[model samples]
Target: MASNSEQKIPTMSRQAAEALIAEKMGPDRVPRKFKIITDTSDFFRVDYNDVVILGDNPYWVKRYEKEGRFGLDDEPKYWVRRAIDLSDGSTKILKLVFHEEFETKIGGISIRCFRSPKKEARILDLVAEHPNFMHGHWVLDSAGNNVRILEFIPGPRYDQLIIDYGTDHQDYFFNYFKEVLDQYIELVTAIKFLHDHGEKHGDIRRDHIIHDRECKVNRWIDFDYNYMHGESMFGFDLQGLGNILIFLTGRGDVLVPELYQQQREVFDRLWGEDLNISYKNRVANLQKIFPYIPKSLNRILLHFSIGAKIFYETTDQMLFDLAKARADVIKLSGRTS
Candidate 1:
């Protein structure tokens, strides 16, 4: 039940993309070698029709070297290298992610650095179907391993977009933000659709929300955090949307009164009674940061924030309404100006 927006994007079938990458990589590359470095159960299926051998002595391979002491948690078990064919000189990276399953409250869920083959296939299927997010990544079947060949998306992250351009970038930023807003709406719509399809995205965060300003589009990148709709941690997805709103407003680190007051209410509801921070001081600060923010909008935000004190059972719907309200105000002001 993916939305029309979700279905509009053109994505290659997992099998078709696999076939193309396999043909390009050629045969007799890995000598039919299959490696399993994970200490977990191997519940993987192999596709002979989509088999591709990774070339020997790949030149463009680079491991991410960090300046930290190596420990059990800091080990790198994957091999990532780029390949460039000489004939037409086409290039792609061969990404291999290895992982193991562990028992958790969420059941025997995978703790992969990347997703498992089935999860990878699901991503491919999503990308093939949704092209607006600018789908360029592909997954190749290598015997039993899942090899990801992705088209590089290079740009500043959406969070950085505001900082880099600020008010001067408002017009450009508005266009970009609108496009991202559509994608974000679509993403949530898709998540709701997934919930309808008996699936859910357990982790939806600003970090996972990717935007390419140059392309004027946004994409939700990692499906590794996806899960079933009724999964224990399902509520995190909605919380993640609130986090996205905080980022979109570009009020990062500003600590507006409305937001603080709203958060205070939630804690009070959970623990009962308000905290020490005076509403007078909080309101004082909002006056300083957003002196130009319309009083009507400020009042709405404050009222909505207070509603959070009551346990925020309807915060998601409230947020969506607030966003539409803000957008409408902006539009009305633009017309008057």
Candidate 2:
């Protein structure tokens, strides 16, 4: 971590930013805004998390100013904020999670709550160990408390990205979906590695994954849901993959038959019979979307699509199998080359 002296973040007053937005975008266009959910006048000169700013409403600018910037002591137990990262000089920011101090008794011993401190320490240590987490994160200094920050992965959610691209570049859907498949492969490999270390990433959501320029190589975010292997698989890894596989493949509105088969079996066993029914129904619609995908590639994608759920049960097994498959494919291609 860089010293705070080496990293200086420019803080702008809410009034100044609002004025600039209003001036440049035109008075007719309502500037992006947020709502203030809590009182924060006691601590700081300013506090962003005290208010939830909605891009549609700018009315809270005045409210935030009136509330003033409350310091760290004023933050709630569950407050999270997206702020500028002081580690690097880059404009990239990170999301910080903060919690209030707690006290309790455990094993007949009095234990002061160190939830915030412990969580930050864990994330910082994780980032240090994982190459994928090398950038865009840090822990913040709180007033006699612990604060944790995660790299603010920039980009729309995968579903939103697909929707945006589909609307603007409908012709590129085929190639884009293929690229997303490659991304899934990379993500699974990383997750497999983590699971190998007995770590479980509890929260795996599209929105949590970022698509920054650097992310194409290695992508994802949100370490809070991460836990140990003994916890839970969260409805099988592949089912989660299948759910997004449909969306990533431009079947966002449905599920493809090949991919649907794998999803039905795993999710049905994990979530319930209802999910399997949903998968089948969705796959029915997907068959129509990719009528033109080459039969061979379609088979391959379909295999992985469902296989994600079944094979992900053991990270080691999945990694070994995937590596072997890649090697076999490489040898065959080598002979041709």
Give the alpha carbon lDDT tens digit for every residue of 1-337 in model 2. 3212113322345665455445644455434553332222232323542222211112122111111112243333224444322222223332233444444322133323333434444545655655444243343332222233344455444445566554432444433444555566677666666556545444454544556654454455554543222234533444344445445544354433444565565323322212222244343223234455334333323433422233235555444554554444334334322
The weakest ten consecutive residues by lDDT in model 1 span 271-280
Q: After superposition, how far is residue 1 of candidate 1 from its true place, in Å?
A: 19
In model 2, how large is the Cα lDDT of residue 185?
Answer: 62
lDDT against the true structure, per candidate, is 0.41, 0.40
TM-score of each: 0.52, 0.49
Native-referenced Cα lDDT, model 1: 0.41
The TM-score of predicted model 2 comes to: 0.49
In candidate 1, position 98 carries an lDDT of: 50
For residues 86-155, write the lDDT of model 1, one tens digit per residue. Answer: 2233554444555535322311233223235456445545655663332434333323345555444455
Native-referenced Cα lDDT, model 2: 0.40
Say which candidate scores most in TM-score: 1
Model 1: residues with Cα > 4 Å off, grouped in runs = 1-94, 100-117, 132-143, 167-197, 227-233, 255-323, 332-337
